[model samples]
Target: MSLTKIVPSKPIKLYCSIICPWAARTWIALTQANVEFEYIEIDLKNKPEWFLKEVNPGGKVPTLKYGDDYLIESAVTTEFVADLLPEAKLLPSDPFELAQSRLMADRFMEFVFPAFRKGLYQGDVAGLSAELFDGIEKFEPYLINAKPFFGGSDHPALAEILVAPFVSRLYLAIESGLVDSATSTKLATDPKYAYFNTWAKNLIASPGVVGTFDKTTNLEQIKERLAPK
Candidate 1:
């Protein structure tokens, strides 16, 4: 391996918060890509002065600093890292394949991201059925034969990395009883998403998605945030 590929003298610095779904994208991408980065956990409640001033003026987690380059935004950072480390093959190599995969991933974000966050942020069961089912309905037919992951295969794909963080959170909430059993039962029984639910159960049990998740505390924080005024 070339020195540039193998060794980054100054480790790529990642400023992130554990709770952020956006930050989790970069985290999963980095792991699957096998890149070495120095992580600086930023306290979202009380962001460091340096993090606020230098890393991200917008005060968001998932700010990437490689050498002098400061990259922000989860999608840009994940894709950029994938492209940079072609050996890892985290993204598609062929041009046509690349375009199609990117399109699907974009669609996943539209349905998956909003629905997951809606349920999580609300911390109530009232709209949970609609939120969970809508995302699955949109994503299921497209994943008719996902082998062991998104699209098809045993290993996780880009869309999985892009969407799994929030899925992980929803599972956490359900397991902790923060979300009602009705919501979980509705998800499991939704005809539009039977396969999707099957896939979700597998994913929630997977190491990559589940390992990064903190079910108990994360739910506590969300509950606190969503509590009535």
Candidate 2:
């Protein structure tokens, strides 16, 4: 298949941080769609004046500036980028598949993410690791029928793109001893989790997923965060 080359009126600019999972999702989708844009690194910790002005309402990362038009929120940004390339549709055409796919993303954000997100923030250290394993279990069965991907898709589908960043972080923590070895072990080895494990492997291998992620540095950061001072 020939690549689709778009002639934009001007280059699009993406304001994002490397570590933000939401930002990471947009980055992956953009890459998968073969869309080109200017990447503007934003220090989420220290918001720049220009960034604040650009994303005035949200002051958030993963903001897309196309010509003079601006968009916020990772999901919206991803959808906007997808629209740019009509040939590379991210969501499926089947209504049932689209709804189910969206449902999986919703499950991860509402149920799986919150369960572990607070634990990671609280510096529960151990709890942060444990909560993720619980979330993985919830995801495992759902992925049981997947073809090395979420929703049994043959390719790295939307759900994989959205969740890979967080999973990558946990996988790193496990290797560095920041997370419990047993939990990571279960996530990787448990038969019940075969679906997620295989799909995760594929997601981990995706160029888009790896391009924005820095596991080694992120591990060191998490370790420093949990260190007993």
Largest lDDT belongs to which candidate? 1
- Per-residue accuracy of model 2 over 91-166 as CA lDDT, tens digit each: 6667787777777777777656764565444557667655665776775544534676655555555656777776
Which stretches of model 2 miss by more than 4 angstroms? 1-10, 55-57
What are the models' TM-scores?
Answer: 0.85, 0.86
Model 1 misplaced stretches (Cα beyond 4 Å): 1-10, 189-192
- What's model 1's TM-score? 0.85
Worst 10 residues of 1 by lDDT: 1-10
- How many steric clashes between backbone atoms does each model show? 0, 1
